[model samples]
Structure formats: C-alpha cells, structure tokens
Target: MDEVEVVVAHSERATLRVGDVFLKVDTDQARIDVEVEVMTLAPVPTPEVLWRKPPVLALAAVPGTTLGSLGGPSTGSPAAWAAAGATIRKLHDAPLPPLRGRSGRSIAALTAELDDECELLVTNGLLPADLVTRNRQIAETALRPWTPAFTHGDLQIAHVFVEGDEVTGIIDWSEAGQGDALSDLATFTLGHEEHLDDVLAGYGTDVDLDVIHAWWSLRSLLAIRWLNEHGFDPFAPGCEVDVLRSRM
Candidate 1:
C-alpha cells in the first residue's frame, strides 16, 4: 500500500482507501456478513468484493465521485440524480437478501422507538420541545403498512457514486434488507430536496409526498443523536435539522 486515506471513521466502523482497494474495518461480524451477501443480491452496481477476513473487508474501489455530500450542493447534474433514482427502483425490484436479524419492524415498534427518541431529545435539550413534537407528529404519517421491498436501508447521497451523469455504483450495504421502498427514497433525498423532482421523474412511478415527508422526519429524528455522537453534525446547514425544519 502506498498511502492510506480514511474514508469514514466513527465508533462503529472505519473505512480506509489505499491504492485502488478500500478496507472496511468493523468489530461486528454479522454486519460484514450482511454486506457481502447483500452485494451479491443487489441488482444495481456495487463495488466488487476483493476479499474479507475477520474485522476487515477489502473491496475494489468504484471509479466515480460520490453523488453528493450531506449539507452541500451536489455538482452532479439533474440527470445524474434521476439515474440514481432509476437505480434505486431497480434495487427495490430485486430479490430480497436473507439476513439473520429483523429486516424491518412493525408500525407499533417504529412508533415506540420514535417516541423514545423524541423524549430523549426533549429531556436532553438537544432540540426545542416544540420542534421535536411537530416533527414527531409529521413522522407518524409514515407508519402505515406497505408491501416489503428490497431496500438499501442507508441510501444517503454520499453512498451513491456517479461519473458523467451515470450512477456508477453505491457503497455501504450493511443495512440492506426488506423494508419500505420510500425509506430509501427519503434517505437519498434527505438533504437534497431540490432534486426531488428529478428523482421522482426517473423513479417512473407516483409516490405519496406525505409519506416521503413523514419518512424524512422519522429518519432525521431517529438519527440526529447518534450522528452527533459519531462526530457528524446533522444540524449543519442544509442537513437533517434543516430537513426537519423545512416541514414546519
């Protein structure tokens, strides 16, 4: 290896890029197992798996810049965002991957979790009580039942890679499983609301905006605390906090 570049580092896992290979290090074996299996099953392009050993998975790097960064404008064209939407649609249509744990949860469970997170936010003064309550109310609309689809689970903009208006690949499959298709859409468009039309046009289907908005609130509320603890600031300009406030 010539030199190593840290791609992402937090408490749970760290990814490093050296030469043309990316090394993902995580103490959790089950997460690695899911990543490998989900990549094999995913319909869209993904980084090629070079090899894997305990606590380390080496992957051939995908040749493209990431689609965008959180809290920042994407240089990718509208066409590129649309291409990503099409890719996500294809993934949702693929066969579901088998996993050892629960791929999704019931509405009751999601609601319970949301309630707990909201309480924590309020109690800790992490957010204004009114803001948290309003977002929580907005999030409730997404708890309705839906047919399970193959979902990427964490389709943040940074996970999608593109080159010349084409989506080359998506990275990070640890959370892939059967879940709400809208969740992927909501996640991808979280901080990039301006591109929603492009993505929806390429999705080639009608989606309920209310459900998408609900998911936006749900995901942001659930993730804000953990993101902060992990050295990510969801409250940064145009990030998750902004996404939530946009609802009000």
Candidate 2:
C-alpha cells in the first residue's frame, strides 16, 4: 500500500498524495468549482481531474517535480523557468474563463486590502517600519488598472511542474481568473527574483520593470501576515522578508 503523504495542511485546507493520486480536501466547494472550470478553460497544462466529491477533489499527479519552493534554491534550469513563462503567456492569451468568480477585483478593493494589511504589518512589528513604508510606497505603482487576462492567480514556483525543459503542469487553479498579467508574473517570481528576467524572456513580450518591482513589494507585504498566521515564518533567512530587505 502506498503511504499517504501530506502535501500541504493548513487551517483552510489540506492535500494528501497517495502514489499517483492527489486528494485535495477543502471547505470551499466554490473554489473547487472554479478549479475544475479553469482547468477546463485554460490553454495550458494542468493536472487531470479524476473526480470530485464536495470536500474531496481527486486529481492525477503531474509527472514531474515542482519547479521550486518558497525561500529555497530552485533546481529548475533557466530554460525550465523560461518554458514556464511561455506557458503563462499562452494562458494569458487564451479566452478568459467564463465565470463570475473569475472577474478581476476592483482597484478600490485592492487598495483597501493593501492598506489594511500594511497596517497589520506595522502594528505587529512584523517588519521594520521603514521597510514597510518604502515597499508600501513602491507597491502603489501596481494599483492601477490593467487589461485583464486569463491569469493563474497563484503562479508560485511550487505550483509549476516541469519535465526537463518543458513545463508539464501548473497546479492550484482556485485563484485563476481574469486579472493583471504582472500579478501572475510577480507571484511566480515572488521569492525567486533572480529568475524574473529568464521568465520574461520566454514570456516573449516587453513588460514594465517598475510595475513588476512594485508588485514584488506589494505581494510580499500582503502575504507575510497570512504566512505567519499559517505557522510559516515569512521573516526567516532568505525568505519573503529577505526578499523585501533586498529592495532597500
């Protein structure tokens, strides 16, 4: 019998892997619906959905290792990162998923969310005041409107799977929808800033470096609180906090 490996376990959800099958257990059935819909609509590779029963979503595991993990060195080659970028480009160019939940958030809402999160960071002393302030200021650049694209909301390195130089699959589509393209880029390169250029290269388009940098600041700031609350330290060495400090 194959051992059930706990892939990820948290307050909101948990995923277990048994051999080639992954069992995703979550409270939000709506999110599972979105994942199924997005995987069907997306023009890129995704895990094959074997079945779903409310809280349990069974998916066949993609045949490759994760591109990388947060705060860890990426074993994926530059070419693999580039391939992942190309895959993202393909998704962005595809028709938007036809779902109300896939609609991008309004700028006002995003601004308010950012403001609230920033206050929490400062109040908790989770990060230095100056660092928080500067990054918050820099993050303002990303608050503007963007032409929505089919975006993989959480395109972290870990969610990207690759076989050799080819991207085999992208997982975790609960956040997929029409949104700012750079948000996906920023999330993909979050703690792995050094790979940004390689990704952009394969994305095969020019991008605003300033906005991308701003998103780096914005994303890291917003995520620290959630990470901490989830029992992960954002301030650990070479982690999200280090990524923020690198800006200064």
Candidate 3:
C-alpha cells in the first residue's frame, strides 16, 4: 500500500495524498461543493474528480510541481511564470460562475472587515501600529470600485503548477468566485514583486499596477491574524509580514 502523505491540514480542512489520489476532508460541505462546482466550470485544467463522499472529496493528482511558494526562492524560468499568467488570464476571461462567494465579499463588507482586522492587529500587538497603519492606507485603493471577473480567490503561487513552460493545472477552488480581477493577480504575485512583470507579460498589458499593489497590502494585512492563529507563521521571512513591509 502506498503511504499517505499529508498535503495540507488546518482547522477548516485537511487534504491527504495517497499515491496519485488526493483526499480532501473539509469541515463544511458547502466549501467542498464549491470546490467541485468551480472545478467543473473553470476553463483551466483541474484535478480530475475521483469520488466524493460528504466532507471527503477525492481527486486525481495533477502532473507537475507548483510554480513556487511564498517565502521561498522562486523556481522555473520567466517563460514558466508567463505561462502561469496566461493560465490566470484564461480563468479570468471564462464565463462567471453563479456563486459570488469568496472573492467578491462586497466592498463595504471587506472594508469593515479590513478595519476590524487592522484594529485587532494593532491592539493585540499582533503587528506594529505603524506597519498596520501604513498597510491600511495602501489597502484603500483595493476597496474602490472595479469590474468583476471570474477569479480563483486564493490564487496562491503554490496552487498553480507548471511543468517546464506549460501550466499543467490549478488547484484549490473553494474560494473561487466573481471578484476584482486584480485580487487574483495580487494573490498569485504577493511576495513576488520581481515576477509581476513576468506574470503580466502573459496576463495582459491593461492591468492596473496600483490596484494590484493595493491588493498586496490588503491581502497581507487581512491574512496575518488568521494565519497566526492557525499555527502558521505569517512573519516568516518572505511571508505576509515581509509583504506588508515591502509596501512601506
């Protein structure tokens, strides 16, 4: 029997890899439903659904490794990064899914949440007050009105795979929804400023650099607390903390 490798485990969900199959166990069935539904609707390559039972959804592992990860040295050549960007552009251009669930959580609601999180980050000494304040200022632009697009809400670098210069698959669709397209780009390129140009090379020339920058601040600020409580270190070098400080 093949050994089961733990892919990711957190309070909300856990994913296990046994040989070529990945078993996802989520606490909320709705999240699993969303993942499955979006995976079916998304135009990009996704893991094949093997089976699903309640909170456990099984999928065949996609070929190729991830593009790279935050806080780590980037892998693959500029071409590979551009390929990933092209893949993102394809997803963004695809027909919008019905659920506006994760990404477009409403500007007013997100603004309120960002303010609350900033206050907590400062009050609890979770982050330096100056750091929080500066990021909050930078994050303001992300709150402004913007056109919507089909988005992979948590389009982290690790979620995208590339073999050579070909993007093989994109995983993790629980957060997929209609939202500001910049947020997707921001999430993918967060902590990877040097690669932004490379990504945009394939993504497009019409992108708003400022909004993407704002999203970098907004996403990093919003993630610190949750990441800390989840036993993850947001302050790790090249991680969320560094991402926030880079904006200052």
Candidate 4:
C-alpha cells in the first residue's frame, strides 16, 4: 500500500500525494476547469493528468525536483534558473488561454483591491502606517496598463521543476491566463532578488525595474493579511515582511 502524504490543505482546497500520483481536491470547479484547459493550451511542459473525479483531479507527478521555495534557500544552479526563465518566456509567447486575465480581473479592479488592502493594513495596525503608505505609493507603478501574455499568474519559484539545468515542468495552472508578463516575472523573483539578473538574461528582454519593484511592494502588502489569516507567517525571515523592508 502506498503511504499518503498530505501535500497541502486549507479551507478552500487540498493536495495529496500517494505514491507517484498527486490528487488535487478543489472546491471550485471553475478553477479546475481552467487548470485542465490551460494545460492543453500551454506550450510548456506540464504534469500528466491521470484522471479526474469532480473535486479530486489526479495527476501523474512530473520528473525533477522543485526550483526551491520562498523564505528558503534556493538549491538550483544559475543555469537551472535561467532555463526556468527561458521556459517562462516560451509560455508567454504561447497563445492566450481560454480564460482571460486570472479570473478576468482588470487593472482597475486590482488597483481598487490594492487600495482597500492598503487601507486595512493601515487602519488595523497590521503594519506600520509609514510602511504601508510607502509600499502603497510604490505599488502604484504596477497599476498601469500592460500587454497581456499567456502568464503563470502565480509563478512562484516552487512551481517550476528542473533537471540538470533543464526545465522539466511547471505546475499550478489554476491561475494561468492572459495577464501582464511582468506580473509573472515579479512573482517568480519576488524574494530572490539576486536571481533577477539571471532570469532577465534568459528572459532575453528589457523590463522596467521600477515596475518590478512596485509589484514586489504591492504583492507583499496585499498578501500579508491573507497569509496571517491562513496559518502562514508573512513576518518570517526572508518572507514578505523582509521583502517589504528591503524597499525602505
């Protein structure tokens, strides 16, 4: 009998690993719909879908280990990171997914949500007034219009898998859609600022550093409250709080 490993579990969804297979149990079928659809449309390598039973979508685990995770030291070589970057560029160049920008959200909607979160951070004393204000101002640069691309809307480093400096697969496609390319870049290099140059090198394009900086601040500010509520520590070493402090 294969031992069951609880990969991740929260109020909204959970992932379980049994042997070489991964079971993604999501309450929202719409997200599952997107995940299944985007995998077919995306040009990049993805996990093999073994089966789906409503809430439980089974996937065959892809080869290679993860690229590392947030608040943790990265183990992949510079070449591996570059390969990940190149893979991302390929995905961006692919045709848009069936769904629009990560749940069809517009820049205006995101801006409004950002402002509301900033206000809450200040009003509830969750963060220092000065810190929230400064980051909020910095976050404004990311609010402007951007060209939509096929984006891994939540392109965290851990989502990418690599083998011997080659990208094997990218996962977590529920957020994949037509969205800002820089948004994906910002998420990938959020805390790993040292790897930004390497990523951009393989990305092989010019990018707005200020906009990247803005996304860092904006993403951290919006995420702190949710993380705190969701049994995660935004204030952990090398985590969201540290990322925010770096801007100051």
Candidate 5:
C-alpha cells in the first residue's frame, strides 16, 4: 500500500500538500474568504473527465470541524445554523468573475439542466415517478424569475467550517457560478433546516421562504437520484449521499 500526505479528507473531496499555493480571495465586509487550488491530476482525453478532475491541492481555512462530522455540532443548532448563514453571506458578498463556460444566467438553461438530470435518473430507475414530478414542479417554481448573485452552487455544512459563532472559511468551488442567490440560500436551508431562522436572520433580509424551501427540496431529490444511479449509498461516510441524507 502506498501513502499520500493527506491534509483533509471527506467522502467527496480531499486535499494534500501544504505548501501548494492556489488562488485565495477574501471580502471581510461582505464576510467571505476562499482559496482555490490547482489540481495535480493529469488531464484525461475526454472533456467530461476534465470536468471531473480533482484539485491538485485544495484547502480552505474554515473554523471548526465540518458541521456534518459525526462528533461535531449538529447544523440544526441555532448557533451552528447562524454560523452557516454568515458563511454563506460572505460567499455571496464576494466579488465574482465572469462565468468561464456556459453562462448560467438563463432560467431556461438552468431548468433544462435540472430536467435532463431528472430524466437521466428516471431512465436509470434511480428516482420514483412521484418524486420526479414533485421535483420538476418545485424546480420550475423556484427558478422562475430567478435573481443572479455570486453563488456557491453546493452550499452544505460539509463544505462550511465554523468556529464558535463565526464561519472561518468555505471550501469547494467546483459548482460555483453567477446564478440565483435564492437558489444558493435554498441549498443551505434544505441541508440545514434546523437552523432556518438563525440563518435567515444572519442573511439580513427578508427572503421568499417558499422559494428557498422548494429549491432545497428539489435539490435533495436530485441528489438522492444521482446517488442511487451511481451505486453510491448516501448513508456511507465521505459519500455525497451521506452529506445529503445528513441534512434531512
């Protein structure tokens, strides 16, 4: 067996090599800080493979252990939720560069992506028909008249680090883009409903709760379907399924 110097490891991602420098950004007044690491993996022939490449060395200086860790504080706790909310606000407040690839500015494009994902999952027998219908309806409802903001598409406790009542940093930028702020907020709420009020309060604005709830529900359903189709059990540690299920 070979060994690699592991800096951080979770079901979905890992980081190694401490001295590797990557892109870092912080917006304190807005309350966000990010560090981006270039991946060391060699590029595969396929573009799809390229999209799936891991960071060569990824690291984010978040405060506490991930909220979803077995022995860590539950994300449902008010303080924990507040911390998560603050972290998200910071991310949202950060200055964003133009989206590199496809412009995610269109609601139609976003809806199409969601629909296609659902269809693929359904075709593979990974999602129940009723759930698919519900998910589609919710996705459509939530996406209509969407408002764009710098968003971390994957906003979950696992990607967030907290210390006491403060969020130190956020990790993972693979799913980031300029998109609906509410969608990002929804992702957080769905994954951390236990801290709903505190999170919203930290957000410092009145948000449409229904839209956020719908988006989160749809996001969870999609995640479940993807896990099922991929033969990945959500209950296992370090698995995307586990992260999603933990939110529930």
Candidate 6:
C-alpha cells in the first residue's frame, strides 16, 4: 500500500496524514494504526458547548484516492443510509468499557440541559422563548421508555464509509457512550427514512422502531433548538438540526 498524505488535521486528537494504513476493525470500525507525523496539535474554536471531548485523530483518505472514504454519495441518500445502519449495528455489538458518568437518557436531565441552553440563547437574543418551550415539549414527548445502550452519539453519513453495498468502515468514536441503542438507530433513521427498514433488517433482531423514532425526534428538537438560539440557521448543510429535520 502507498503512504497516505496528511491532508487535514482536527485539533490535537487526530490528523489525516498521507501514507497511513487504514485497517478495518471488523465490518464497522477503522482507525489509523500509525503515529501522527507532526507534533504540533491545534485547537478547534467553537461556541457550541459539548457534553464530552472530541476524538484525538480524525482523518480520511482523499476522494478518488487509494484510501478515500470508501465510495457512494455523501449524506442521507439510500446508499449512505444502508452503510450507516450496517456500521452502527456492528459497533453496538462490540464489547464496551464500563461507563463512569451520569446518564443523559432521562427526559428530565435532557430537558434541563435544553432549558439551560434555551435560556443562554434567549439571553443572547438569538431565539424566542415560545420556540424554546415548544422544543422542550417535543423533547419530552419524543423520549419515552428511556432504555440505554452503547451508542455512537454522532452517527451520520459523513461518519460512515462505504464501498458499494458493503460498509468499508465506521469512523469517529468521540461521542460514543453507554446509552439507548434505539437512539443510535433513530439518529441515523431521522435523516434517511428510505433505508430505515433495510438498516433495521441488517440488525438481524427485533428492535422497536417506535422507540427509535421517538429518540430521533427528541434528538432533532434539541439540536435545532440549540442552533436557533445561537443565532444561526438550523437548516444549513452539515447542521445537525437540518439533518434531523430532513427525516421529519
């Protein structure tokens, strides 16, 4: 294999370097098996408050290159959806380390966080109070029967790599945690409904689609509420709210 070049770097966690090996960890997971070539790590500046730290290394092969991010269209399409579902199922089946943090699966806790975020946004004059309330209701109503499982909190098309009908690799383990499995499914389903059945079929088990749908709805509301309060349009490309709304 040829050496992959370092094309992009994200913070201090990971860098996309040239000549790096892309080994497949099962059918879902993939990682850089080599040390980064550069020493200086940069910080990502953003106003969005996060629940956890991002990954250390985030890299992918160049498009049309030997080790590109697999193949197929980028996001929310049928091919991308199938790949995402397959990858997530594989990840969920992997053994996980013991969780050592408070759970975010509870409606009250999620609502509290949403409330605080709304207050912050309103204080900054970014959104209306009524919209915040509406979003809160949506969140509370959507997240029912809170069961937790190991979830890829940031599951999306860009995070998954596909080559034809098979999933090449699943990338980005930053927001991973012990949470509701359905939430992970919902996270993907919210964007690509066409592949919902296929994705679930890939799981090879009976999963409650309603539960997944609820989780997706609640997640969408929370994300959109945050974006709206921050004075940014929630429908922009790469926007979490937009991705969620596409499902609705």
Measured by lDDT, the strongest candidate is: 3
Residue pairs in clash, model 3:
none
Best by TM-score: 3
- Candidate 2 on 8-91: residue-level lDDT in tens? 999999999999999999999989989999999998889999998889999999988877788887878889889988999999
Model 2 clash pairs are none
Please provide, for model 4 over 92-111, each residue's C-alpha lDDT reduced to its tens digit, 9 standing for 90 to 100. Answer: 99977767856236888998
* Cα RMSD of predicted structure 2: 1.4
Count the clashes in each prediction: 0, 0, 0, 0, 8, 15
The C-alpha TM-scores of every prediction are 0.96, 0.96, 0.98, 0.97, 0.66, 0.58
Kindly indicate the candidate among 4 and 5 with the higher lDDT. 4
Estimate, for each residue in 16-51, the C-alpha lDDT of model 1 and write its tens digit: 999999999999998998998989988899999999
Error of 4 at 120 (Å): 1.2
lDDT of 3 at 59: 93
lDDT of 5 by residue, 1-248 (tens): 33445544444444453333222222221111121310111110101111212234224233455667322345445776676676667656656535421224476776777777778767877655665676567556676775466676666656666666666556555555666677777665553455678888778666888777667655655566555545546445533333333434
lDDT of each: 0.88, 0.88, 0.92, 0.88, 0.53, 0.48
Candidate 3 stretches greater than 4 Å from native: none
lDDT for model 4, please: 0.88
lDDT by residue (42-122, candidate 6, tens digit) is 011111211212233333432221112212233334554555565667656655424411223466676676667657646
Candidate 4, residue 186: CA error in Å?
A: 0.7
Query: Per-residue error at 95 for model 5, in Å?
Result: 3.6
